[model samples]
Target: MTSWVDMPLCAVDTETTSADPNTARLVTACVAAINGSEVDSRTWVANPGIEIPAEATDVHGITNEYVREHGRPHDEVVAEVVEALYVAWESGRAVVAYNASFDFTVIANHSPGFEVRGLIVDPFTIDREFDAYRKGKRTLADVCEHYGVRLDGAHSADGDALAAARLAWKMPRVYHVLALASADSLMESQANWYRERQYSYIDYLRRNNRPFDDVSVEWPVRTQKATAA
Candidate 1:
């Protein structure tokens, strides 16, 4: 049996205008392919067609003026990114991301009619499942530290994406059961894991008298609400 670490993997990450995936416009995106000892990466920068808020620019270091002057058009970047993802999917590789739901959702929002294929390996979701009792943060950098993976250039899409891929590659070694499961099985487990986590959060919110109950159980991509015609 082939170890999961040896399998071809595609890691994706994106820098956006805001934290809300539904409304955030992509500022930059990266996709990294890892197969055994070989690794390749591609990055895209787009104007986003909106103001890249000061806070967001500070985080990713991509200013609106910089993108306007050097970045590709939004639609062009989206098509290229989507095509890269599709190629990875078609090649029987797992698509990975730190917080996959956010990146996948942002891509879906931008790609519109394009369909997202392949099994998604979310290192963040997997870490939550395997280390549910561990305290403190689970940000990409935090998880990288926990897994002994080096994550440099924290907010840059290329750096983050490659780090996420390395983290996913390390997960199965930490959790033996994950290494035994097929990619499809892992994807299904992540869906269940996300739902369970959301329910726990909702319960905590309700117990604390907080009115926060709009969380979605969907994995990789949350279902978008229909707009009024």
Candidate 2:
């Protein structure tokens, strides 16, 4: 079987108004396509239709004023973002993201009743499953460095999207089992990996008498805005 590293991948990254996908709005988004040696990308900036909190702006450096001046309508930008993902799926490419659950959930919520279908490649989930004992943060930058991949921009959508693809591309090269596996199968395995990790965390919380009510096991996407603790 051909390795996914040798095939095209459509990686997406979104900067939003909040951490919770349920209430967050799209502030900026990028869908980056990696076809072997070539990289092509599209980016979107949205007004979000609400204030971008100071904390959110600090993370991505995308201010409400900047978006307001440059953005299209929030709904229109979301619709086009989803359409772009659809195009990737239609073209038989896996959709990649760093923390896919968050980005994908934000897209799903912003477009109500929309079906987010595709073979999803989540580098975050893959790392968690494959490198279960490694310590320290798995933020995209950290992961990129851990895998010896360069990330020029930390929070920009295009940079992160492309970085995710690079990180994912490196994973299979590091883990031969993944190199031999198909994206569809690996995505399914990620679902199980996510669930297993959530179960372990919940058990830890229970043992330590901490609240785990908001710990979600959803992989790739969550259909609704979750009130996580």
Candidate 3:
């Protein structure tokens, strides 16, 4: 199949033990059409090796007992997933994810003994690039709601993957612009944009003699101790 963005673009996603991708196991995977049609789709449930916590189960609906009883062996399925990713990456198609960093990081971390390759396309990062003025939340549901796209199923990997693909189709201008940017260029653009914003903030502080230096510079919170606490 011709890739939606390039060649058979993979809309990959997973349900894991937790939010940390490294420690999380690939509970499921889905590949869908980037152009609003459902194509080859796949889902897998793995033992994860680690016990599935109730909270995680509550989120994705995969429970420890269910996985232990019906899922494939972890290593074998993970190997297959890795191989598929490598093939897609080699084919020059982008892997789509909502917050790609987390997904990529998780996949990379979990598939340590496996081999895979692919360039990742993260809508979260892309939004930061094109919609700098966009305010409020940017979850998949939010994007779907904003774009008038229907989110049929959520939480499941297949559903989220398809939703992400549809979200891409909804924001063509942003997607096309980023698709043309090299990875380095895209990251550099984000860095420069944030750098400018930081400078503006610093200048404002300096002009007002607001003791900006005394204010901590740590992200999420200005005060390191406060953040830690």
Alpha carbon lDDT of each predicted model: 0.85, 0.85, 0.63
lDDT at residue 89 of model 2 (Cα atoms): 85
- Per-residue lDDT, model 2, residue 20, is 84
Better of 2 and 3 by TM-score: 2
User: lDDT by residue for model 2 over 1-229, one digit each (tens)?
Assistant: 6555555788999999999887899999999877778888899999999999999999999987898799999999999999999999889888889989999889988788777576888888889998999999988888998999979788999988988988877888898788876666777898888878877887888789998777777877764322232
Each model's TM-score, in the order given? 0.93, 0.93, 0.71
Error of 3 at 210 (Å): 20
Question: How big is the positional error of residue 132 in model 2, measured in Å on the Cα after superposition?
Answer: 0.7
Model 3: ten consecutive residues of lowest lDDT: 220-229
Q: Candidate 2: where is the Cα deviation over 4 Å?
A: 1-6, 224-229
lDDT of 1 by residue, 1-229 (tens): 5544556899899999999888898999998888777878899999899999999988989998899998999889988999999999999888889899898888888887867677788999998988999999999998999889989799999999989988888888888888887766777889899878877877777778876545666778877421111
Better of 1 and 3 by TM-score: 1
Q: Please give the lDDT score for candidate 2.
A: 0.85
